[model samples]
Target: MKARITVMRTVGAAVMAGALAWGVVTGAQTDTPPQDASVEAVADAAPGYAVEDYNYPQADKILAEKNIVLKRGDGHIVLADCASETGLLEVWARSRDKICFKVTGNSGWLTLEIPSVYGVKGSADQTAQVDMTVGSEEKSFDVAKNSFAAVGESADEQGRDYMLVEIRTAK
Candidate 1:
């Protein structure tokens, strides 16, 4: 009778331990909390996306400060103080005198407006092409590296004034 009671107690303890282990495993597997409406609402609170338009930055301030109407560019060319550095492309116009631009990268382009442009001085390492217009007619000039080239009225037989509109350069 004593042996039977001991055996039955041991069996009961084993069954209880097995049940506890199964409960622990089932609880662990379902530990993740249920999703609620608050979780969905958090997604709407995130920030929006960003986009780039490529328009010239601070153009109005530049125009106000320098009297140059900078329109657009690939960000490879920019206006610079004439005395700031050497090897800058120089644009000569009757109204603006000499304006300088610094060129960077392998190639670049800038579109701007400078009236009465007659000549361009190219940078040392890159050749340049200048586009001008007078009335409805358009013209293009090739400027050799590190040299002064006549354009606009100086190049035209009729001596018509031209507005410098665009500049393209390559290394």
Candidate 2:
């Protein structure tokens, strides 16, 4: 009877230890939280705004400082200080003696404004056409390569004030 009792007590202890180990493993596994199936959008995933690279640089500053309403231009034509370089397309005005543009490449076009220009001097090897405006009238003139040409008020019969508006050049 004594031996049988000891055997039964040993069996009971084994069963209790097995139950405790199983409980510990299950409790450890349940510590991880569950994930939901619902989806949601986030604000940072949207696209960002950007500026166009082709737009002219410092255009607003140029307008404010020069009093020039330079709208746009092909990269081939650009502003220059007079006599700084050769083969410039020069705008001679009644107010300012000259405004210069460095003309390069074989062909180019620019839209700009010099309030009272009356003459244009062409690049060394390229012919240019200039557009001018006076009141309600618009006119165009062709300038020869490497030479001066009358435009704006100089080309007018009544010699009215005129604004230089455009220039297109070709080799």
Candidate 3:
């Protein structure tokens, strides 16, 4: 009788452990809590800023429209190619002839690069200013994060443009 009791207890423990493990796996796969509806509504209102697909021309045009040039020198365009290859969405904005980009991916990393003609100044907590020209446009911008703004409508000081890129991994 004692032997049978011990066998039943062992089976009960195994079943409970299996149930607990299944619950954990399933919970992890469940969707995250819904985001704020107001935020979603605002996002819906701004379709132009949306990043739906990442395929060449579409991606290239999106960046170009904002006067952003990716992969100017060599190496890689950083997030540009990765965003396209991985089908992630990104946005670019040009302020004062400088380019600022932000990317949000389904998984992995998001990167931004800003070129500085005079190189970045100070530390991350400090502000950095850069001057440059895009075509006939002259501009200057103060970079708080990884961004670039032009100084004025003038030929690139060094006759070459510089860029700073930032990448962040998504959860």
Instruction: Using TM-score, give the best candidate's number.
Output: 1
Question: What pairs collide in candidate 1?
Answer: none
Deviation of model 1 at 158, angstroms:
0.8
TM of each candidate vs. truth: 0.71, 0.66, 0.22
How does candidate 1 fare on TM-score? 0.71
Is candidate 1 or 3 superior in TM-score?
Answer: 1
lDDT by residue for model 2 (74-95), tens: 7777778886988788889986
lDDT of 1: 0.91
Query: After superposition on all CA atoms, what RMSD does each candidate show versus the true structure?
Result: 11.4, 13.4, 18.5
List ranges where model 1 is wrong by over 4 Å: 1-50
TM-score, candidate 3, is 0.22
What's the CA error at residue 101 for candidate 1, in Å? 0.2
Whichever of 2 and 3 has more lDDT, that candidate is: 2
Off by over 4 Å in 2: 1-55
Clashing pairs for model 2 are none
Question: Which of the predicted structures, 1 or 2, would earn the higher lDDT when compared with the native?
Answer: 1
